[model samples]
Target: MIDIDIRPAVPADAGAVLDFWKTAAEGTSISDDVAGVTRLVQRDPGALLLAESDGVLVGTVIAGWDGWRASLYRLAVHPSRRRQGLSRALLDAAEERFVALGGRRGDAMVLEANEPAHHAWAAAGYRREDHWRRWTKPLA
Candidate 1:
């Protein structure tokens, strides 16, 4: 097992997390901003999980539970840390969180074009629900 610390992100980590995402994560969303991330941490302290190795952030995943659903987003691992057990470690932590909170099922938001991520998610026991489609509208 990798000797790393897996914990919830704090308020001060917002900016650094955003910077990390730019390099490690694929694609982006409006909530990718520091301000938005700060708000998320402020609102739900345990939702954002960060993986640190040797005191440096290497991966992240949002295990959001809002009473009704367990939703995941922003699952990213650093390039140098790829092919290791970090992703599984993170997902295991996230799933444990969901079970602790009485979450019946967990769903992830994966980009359609991210083939590598498809393999990872599949390896993690997540399957594609082709019958479902995500609908979004920006609230500007």
Candidate 2:
């Protein structure tokens, strides 16, 4: 097992994180760009969590807490680094952050079609809320 270091993303890490997501993440979001990520880092520095090994990026997860709800997003692991506990490590860090911030529960956004991700989430003890549907309109 490699020594994985999990930490909050800094402003300088935005570009690399974007590139990592393009390869590691299953799908892209409107806020996956450099500008959007930079804005996120500027606003909430500890919201974006990253996992690295020997300075190379391996995984990422966003634990967003807005006083009431704790939302998790962008959980991704490098293709070459999957099934090695990277995702679990990232989630553990994210959950710890949320708990520290007085967050009661955590919600994750998992794609309906991503079966692998679904299994992973289940393994992490997160179950899908079949009663809820996501509705959104792009601002751009």
Candidate 3:
């Protein structure tokens, strides 16, 4: 296994991140584009974390802290790199960031159809909130 390096993403990484997500992530979001990601990096520089093996992107996770809540999103690993502890590394960095920010709890948005993600999140000590329903409105 190659050594993995986890770090915060930069504006220049937006394109590569979008492309990586297309192959590694289970689903797409409206804000998965380059512009959206660039905005994220510019706004909250440490929120978007990237994992690289020999400088090639292998994993990504968004650990967003908005003063009150710590929300996680886009937790993805390269299909070829799955089950190799890449996700765990990313989550560790994310949770550490939250802890440093005085965050009490963290929430993740996982797609219901992505069973693989469900298991991973569960293994990481996250439980599914079946009683809650997600509501969204597209601003675009």
In candidate 2, which residue ranges exceed 4 Å CA deviation? none
Clashes counted in candidate 3 amount to 0
Per residue, candidate 3 scores C-alpha lDDT tens digits across 1-140 of: 54899999999999999999999998889998889999999998899999999899999999999999999999999999999988888998999999999998989999999999999999898999999899999999
Cα lDDT for residue 109, model 3?
96
* TM-score order of candidates, top first: 1, 3, 2
Across residues 43-99, which tens digit of lDDT does each residue of candidate 1 receive?
Answer: 878889999999999999999999999999999999999999899999999999999
lDDT of each: 0.94, 0.92, 0.94
Best by TM-score: 1
Clashing pairs in 3: none
Per-residue lDDT for 1-140 in model 2, tens only? 65899989998999999999989998888887889998888888899999999999999999988899999999999999999999999998998999999998899999989999999999999999889999999777
TM-score of every candidate: 0.98, 0.97, 0.97
Candidate 3 global TM-score = 0.97
Query: How many clashes would you count in candidate 2?
Result: 0
Candidate 1: residue 14 Cα off by (Å): 0.5
Model 2 weakest lDDT span, ten residues long:
1-10
Q: How many residue pairs clash in each candidate?
A: 0, 0, 0
